[model samples]
Target chain A: MTAESNITWKANFPDSFLWAEWEDEEASVFFHRGSGETLLLNPLGAYLLKTICSEDISEEKLAQRTVRYFDLPVDEELLSAISVSLHTFEQKGLLLSSASQ
Target chain B: MKPLDLKPGEIARLLRSNGLRLQIGPFAVSLRSRLRRVAEQIAFFYGDYPRIEADAFVDFHIQINNPAGLRHWVRPQAIFSFDGFKPFKPLPEDQAFAMFEWGLNWCIATTSHQFLITHAAVVAKNGQAIIFPGEPGAGKSTLCAALVSRGWQLLSDEMALIDPGDLSITPVPRPIGLKNESIAIMKNYGDETLVGPPVTDTIKGTVAHMRPPADSIVHADRDTRPGYIIFPTYSAAADSQLDKVEKTRALVRIAEQSFNYHILGREGFRTVERLVSRCPAFDLRYSQLDSAIAEIDALL
Candidate 1:
């Protein structure tokens, strides 16, 4: 996965999330009462939540960075699989993609 | 530790499990964590035995039996213990460890104090505990998390330990758990120091625990007299207020809600009688945290 797509999904989460932590088998979740949304996440999704919590990044860069962190055998298929996870996060309202990306 | 032989004299015993050695004091307990985290909120809140002095001890002895059963014992000044036959199958993980903790608290609190433990959020100020008891989704925890942040000593977020002898509240201060929305909303109001990760999909939307302030934990051993009993109900976006409840009516309401009132029978009735006579009861419905805090603080 390219770094851009990886963390870019974090943009959807609001800054007011009170508690965001890995729930393990359930992955990580971010709770925001303002939005009244609690998003469940997977391992990569949780990583994305932490990355976004730390700072903002673009989609392509997020995808790339995520691939690097996993130490997977480098390839486009690996990148595409990771992007699918990002899409699931977006569907869950956990990530917001910038139109520019 | 030997598999706790649930015999008569074994109400309280110390042993080793999972590398942690726990000293089970009369009402309190002390444990050393075998894992990396200092002491999980559970240990600190429930293990308030006199051994809190911090002596080097073995890792927290852990026996999966009764999972959260360790929390049921009362603290140093009192002795209350029970041994339930382990269920052939562990309680399904869907129920929280907190529930078991509260259940165990119910058993011991009822046995020793002959008091009913209620599902509620309780707070104390000036030696009086104001109980906000209700069912889940009644906004008890949300209101409680807010009140403690505004200076109320958190007596408990889940268990209201009422003494049948005097109708007073025995403080069992512990971390408050907030499900999904409440977790975020509490932070929006400016409390950001919540501990523990959020658990998802078990029952509550998402859940997390906020540590009771240091002072609450330090004074976890102290008891607060019952002052006012308020049964709180929270709304999504509605006018908030507290109104006085009649004595006879409030008595019935409490008996219905108390965890141990039935355990002690007549004694429970008289104890609650003493409480209503000495304390005022109210029905509070609130949607705003600030207004709720202001209303309660002003009453204190």
Candidate 2:
């Protein structure tokens, strides 16, 4: 997908998902449950999912925010990863696309 | 009045005729068994358990005896009945007492929903409770037996009953099931008076039950908030070690090991989340009983 394509992907998370989390120096664990599925997420994945649930944000904005806040390398690969993660979340019914909502 | 207050002959007569009503933990149990060995064991082992009044509400009506058949003479077998329905196939006649214990556990696990029950051994010290959740061979019962003898109160040796209303653990103190080498270990490590006769060959190898301390039964209704969630692993080559378990991991493990977690669904998830958040979790491994006790004592 083009860099501009990432800017159109606004998503939301359902309220029915129950969650519990724990974090250490290396990674954070997220136990997310809803619709008969329980998913375990790493720190980056958990952050991305929680961000979507907490706000109505696009994939490009989330990636930019993540890179700025966590001081990660900003590159094409990182942007592609963010787009793929948001899509994965939508496929799992964890993220509700603005069009779908 | 305690069961001991009744003469053994009277207890036997009631078992053979009407039934003996017992106040075990929060449940009213009516047990009827004609086997003489059951009566003798009840007199010796259950003497400390107080008798529930005849008019009280009975939660489970149980009976253990040899069924009428030609096999009654050829190869006698004892059947355990709950509410007039037999849930299990008849075991050897000699396993009547053990059957009673197993059946009682089945009754509670299947019926109780007000409390979140887990397959764990719970013991308390200094007003704090430690819940030991483990599989069948995890040495939980052996650890429970040893802890209760060293001045800790035995809440229960098989089940940890957590009242959902307040999240406090209610004591259901009963006998600690010791199996195989652990039975011998408990006898050698602690006072012999704490244990009962070994019942062999029924299911989980050679099994013996250790009677709970009298003080534990006397304070059966008192509830304590959980302070620690410990998963014990017994290994002969391992040195005593207590490793910290992360909260999320601890919650998942407890839910996986619970008797009614799935049945309770979202409520079960919330209860375990609250419990794990409030209590520190650990994995303890030990080979020696004394050292294991010492490490746990240090926790309090």
What's the C-alpha lDDT at position B252 in model 1?
A: 60
For residues A3-35, what per-residue lDDT tens digits would candidate 2 score against the true structure?
443344433334655677654533333433454
| lDDT string, candidate 2, B78-193, tens digits | 99999999999998887888889999999999999888999999999888999999999999999999998888999999999997667899999988889999888899878887
Misplaced by over 4 Å in model 1 are A1-101, B1-26, B30-62, B65-84, B87-113
Chain A only, candidate 2, TM-score? 0.74
> What is the Å distance of residue B26 in model 2 from its true position?
0.7
By TM-score, the best candidate is 2
DockQ of each: 0.01, 0.26
In order, the candidates keep a fraction of the true contacts of: 0.00, 0.24
Residue-level lDDT of model 1, residues B267-289, one tens digit each, is: 55556556766788888888899
